[model samples]
Target: MPRYLSILTFAAALFCGACQNSHSDSKNQSSPEAGVKPAFVAQRGTPVLDGSGSDDLWEASDWLPINQIWAGTLPKPDDFSGRYKLAWDENNLYILAETTDDVLLDVHPQALEHFWDDDCLVVFLDEDASGGTHEFSYNAFAYHIALDGSVADVAPDSSFRYFNDHCLTRRIARDNVNTWEIAVRIFDGKQYKDEGDNVPMLLKKGKKMGFALAYCDNDHSAERESLVGNVPLPNTQNKQQWLNADVFGTLELR
Candidate 1:
């Protein structure tokens, strides 16, 4: 049998919440309904990730809504609005996100502590899409991408660590609108190493993975005000995605 999350050794850590939201037991075990997963196709394109979606390949896929409120109160229309597009090639997974916010905050300068409250992007990924609890292992990853281009994730040691090289990000903020372009390199969670050299997988057609995108909004407060996700989760009250891969949406390479 394949090891999805090392479940037999499952032990909830002291800090298992995401964006200050705790995990829910029922939602963590929920899978896609009747095995019918929501599939978003990634168009085959190698676009230039220069904080600007100027490449022609960017038009390949339609903009996906980032309107699902996974945690906290829903913001006003002018307070926050966002949409994103996905594209991939043999080298990397490209993401173009456009967010209009009344204010951008990066309160937590330290990447490891309370980074989720810094108004960043959270990327949830499961290499094989085998849904399970990944609160303390590399079976899946919840990457918190900060505004300063800092990336952090929980390591196998159950401690927060920077995985900056995993995702290269660039953003151009003008007025109150921000255009963020990121190039993501996928790694096998089962084989990922903290101190060892790991090569990212080359994307190909027909490949499937568990994936979701979210944003944390904060306006100078100690905690984030809202958490907007891409997928519509069942429990609108709790953030099950705090550490579960089952709450994410599905993505297939085209």
Candidate 2:
């Protein structure tokens, strides 16, 4: 991956803004995340970033079901189903998810538009596992990764921004299953800046952070049909993860 990919992504975002974004809070970080969140362990290893999940290192991890319903109705297996595996190294957090959706759609090519309404993977992250309302800040990020490999999130300014550089991804679909492999640079939400030069953190063992994973499924519709999460969430029927980081799950770099 290009080391300065974030710069390119940001530049492209600005260009898109020339063509034509609620995100309303700008704290560096927030209070400890709410609730006794689910704890997950990420084994230490580096896997090939290729969408093909053929690496032997993956065997060290287990597939965690991303089956919790956060919105809409529970989709049939043939319609939608997902599970993921996690692994990490000093530079990045790696996620491997296998999802089956009868059809994939990304109507909004513009990242700033209704990104969630399309078929995408939304990754919720709290840098320190200390969460609060980050709707308007970098204290956390809700990365909506589109099928085209573009990543979208609300910047501190509350404007839609593409964080494509933060996430290096690849997707391979075969036999109805789309395997997504993502390598995410762990940035301290408090230190990340859109116009300023920033660096990713060097992760270590036992490091804890708040995170959650989900998918928005839109099978030929004006909007998404279902939203599924990896962990059980409070107010299971209400989707608060986009605004509240307190509802996220905790992860430790093991």
Clashing pairs in 1: none
lDDT of 1 by residue, 1-254 (tens): 34645553343442344313423422432123323555677899887778987778886567877876788888886788888888888888888998888989987786488888889998888989997888789888888899998899877788889989989999999898898999899999899888988999988898998888889988868899898887767667465655788877788888
The per-model lDDT (C-alpha) reads 0.80, 0.84
TM-score of 2: 0.84
Q: Look at candidate 2 and give me any clashing residue pairs.
A: 25-136
lDDT of 2 by residue, 1-254 (tens): 58599889988998666533100111111112224467777999999999978898787667887777788878999889998889999999999999999998989876579899999998888989887988889888888999998999888788888998899899998988999999989898888889778889999999999888999999988979999887666666766654787877888999
Task: State in Å the error of residue 210, model 2.
Answer: 0.1
